[model samples]
Target: MADKEVQNSKKPPSKSVSVVNKTSSVSEDTPKTVPNKGPQVLCLRILNSLNENMKSQKERFEKLESAQYYD
Candidate 1:
């Protein structure tokens, strides 16, 4: 009876180890299945272009204001 109990205890540890291995493997695969970054990249590009346009507009406005002051 003592031997049977020892064997059962050993079996549970092995099962727990296998479960841990499976969870680790699943976690490793998660990054590979990540959503595509295409939309995020496109949005960043658009925001950058808008920022550039805003800067140019501000420069033009400043130039016009200075010209009016000099007139």
Candidate 2:
């Protein structure tokens, strides 16, 4: 019984990238929506600054992964 259970567990499960048997034209005509570009640029700059800031902080705090994490 244990061996049967192990064999069943070891069996690979199936996964589908696509779903089947939909009634409607569930396919999208086009993708939806847009995001603000300004925030993205700001985020990039902030992330870069964070990396720089963390480099020094690690020496002060052994727990810190990076000095940039504080900023």
Candidate 3:
């Protein structure tokens, strides 16, 4: 078992591992992002939905406040 452990730790004679240890190789001079027209449309739709929800909430709050006048 000890002999096998030693043999396993050493790389196989013919194999050389090209290890990439860096997070990114891109330079600051390169463009940070590629253009995506799809995500922009999605983001606009999300914003519009959120705005609708906010209006609904505001109307509900006003209704609750009006109901509290008699209490």
Q: Per model, how many backbone clashes are there?
A: 0, 4, 0
What lDDT tens digits, residue by residue, belong to model 1 across residues 1-71? 99998888876444333334432112223233335689876665566666667778999999999999999
Query: Candidate 3's residue-wise lDDT over 1-71, tens digit each?
Result: 99998989996679678988875322435443446778876675566666667778999999999999968
Find the candidate with the highest lDDT and give its number: 3
lDDT of 2 by residue, 1-71 (tens): 89999998997878768768754321233223336578866675565566556655756576554646766
Can you list the residue pairs that collide in candidate 2? 53-67, 53-68, 54-67, 54-68
Q: List the residue pairs that clash in candidate 1.
A: none
- Which 10-residue window of candidate 2 scores lowest in summed lDDT? 25-34
Runs off by more than 4 Å, candidate 2 = 1-12, 15-36, 59-71
Cα lDDT over the full model 3 = 0.70
User: What TM value does model 1 have?
Assistant: 0.49
Per-residue lDDT value at 62 in model 3: 96
Question: Which has the better lDDT: candidate 2, or candidate 3?
Answer: 3
Winning model by TM-score: 1
Indicate the residue-level lDDT of 25 in model 2.
24
Candidate 3 off by > 4 Å: 1-36
Q: Rate the local accuracy (lDDT) of all candidates.
A: 0.64, 0.59, 0.70
